[model samples]
Target: MKILLANPRGFCAGVNMAIQCLEECVRMFGDNIHVYHEIVHNKYVVERFTKLGVRFVDEVSDVPEGAILVYSAHGVSPAIRQQARDRKLQTIDATCPLVTKVHMEAIRYARQGYNIVLIGHEGHDEVVGTMGEAPESITLVDTPEDVEKLSFAPDAKLAYLTQTTLSVEEAGRLIAKLKERYPQIESPPKEDICYATTNRQHAVAQLTERADVVLVLGSQNSSNSQRLKEIAKSLGRPAYLIDGAGEIQEDWFTEDNNVLITAGASAPEVVVQEVVNYLKTTFNAELEEVVTREEHVTFPLPKELRQLQLSN
Candidate 1:
């Protein structure tokens, strides 16, 4: 069996920065670290941090007053920040700069009196945080069908923002629909989808063409991971999204099949290697790597963590 592994498949710069921030928090403050949400969307990462005594809370109220609370890479709404402030939490923001850029765009559009249409999945942490920036002014739409149901005057000012982790193809289709519906609609100054997401999806798109089956390693809740699976399945290939090698189904594999393996931006390379090792041992698979793009982007650790390092 031949295994096609995708380069640029895992651990984007933002995820790296968030994970490092949490690690530094653990080292500096030990068990006192509390994160607002899953640092990224990988289960293994959250579990590892939990094992290290870091608390993950969906609500700010769950965190003890005045505790050291770190925002997740998904970023939080202003209200959540205010809540933390009210509780006197020592906040360390690990929000990805790309995500932050979307937030700023949302705020900017809202301030300009343009009704913002946020293109993202409902109830997603990133979407929720972004909508919270200007709830009254922002509308969430995941599909072209949702756009049809939107109620806005023909002459109303409008702007669109997108989730950073969205599939490039899916978002493009949605944007096309939006533009068709509102000829004068405004787009973000730049693409809101992060470069990491685009690169990983592009890598998967290139590899899936030659493979009989595709395996994407990431948590179910991970948006980018889900997009990768969708991209493969959309191409009529049988695709599976697994958190790790243990979730891999032997039934899906055959001696004659060529399998493609890729991982989400937040998924660790170690997990990808685990899947590769299992395939190699179980099927004697010959690995062929397909490099779609080279990525060198990096985000700095949170300012609070950097100052702590400097003080030491």
Candidate 2:
């Protein structure tokens, strides 16, 4: 069996920055760190951090007063920031700059009196936070069918933004529907989907064609990871999303079938390698890497961590 690995599979810039922030916080301030969310939506990553004494909380109110808190890479609303401040928590923002950009766009459009339509899953951390920016002004839509269900007037000034992790093709179709309904709908100054998502999806789209089955290494809660599996399944390939190699099943593979593997932005490469090793040792699979694009993007550590390092 031949195994095709997707390049740029794991650990995108935002995930790198977020993990770095948590590591730095641990190194600088000790193990009593609190994060607002799962950090980057990978179970393995979260468990590793949990073992290191990081606390993940669903609400700012759960954090003890004056505790050191790190925001997740998914970003948070201004209200959450204010809540943290109100508690006098020492805050380190690990929000991906790209996610922050979408929040900024949402806020800007809201201020300009344009009804904002954010395209993303309704309960997703990123979508929830972005919508919190202007709940009164922002309307959330998950699909093109949702766009048709919207009850906006013909002359309403409108703008649209998207979750950074959405499928590029899916977002395009939804945007097309929006345009058809509201001819003057404003778009973000730039594409809202981040580069990492686009590149990974492109790799899967190209590699899935040649494989009988595909495996995506990421947690079930990860939006980007789930999208990778969905993309492969949409292409008529059997795809599985697993947290790591341990989740792989013998029945999912057959001696005659070639497999494709990719990982989500938050997944570690070590996990991907584990899956590869299993295939090699078990099936004697020949390995090939499929690279659709090269990524050189890197995000800086959060400001507080930078200042602490400078002081030390």
- Tens digit per residue, CA lDDT, model 1, 121-233: 99999999999999999999998899999999887899999999999888999999988889899998899999999999998888888999999999999999999999999
- Model 1 scores a C-alpha lDDT of 0.94
Model 2 TM-score relative to the real fold: 0.98
Q: TM-score for each prediction?
A: 0.98, 0.98
Model 1 vs. true fold: TM: 0.98
Q: What is the C-alpha RMSD of each candidate to the true structure, in Å?
A: 0.9, 0.9
Clashing pairs in 1: none
User: What tens-digit string does per-residue lDDT give for candidate 2 at 1-312?
Assistant: 889999979999999999999998999888889999899999999999999999999999999999999999999988999999999999999999999999999989999999999999989999999999999999999977899899999989999999999999999999999999999999999999999999999999988899999999999998999999999999999999999889889999898898999999999998999999999999998999988899999999988889978998
**Regions of model 2 farther than 4 Å from truth:** none
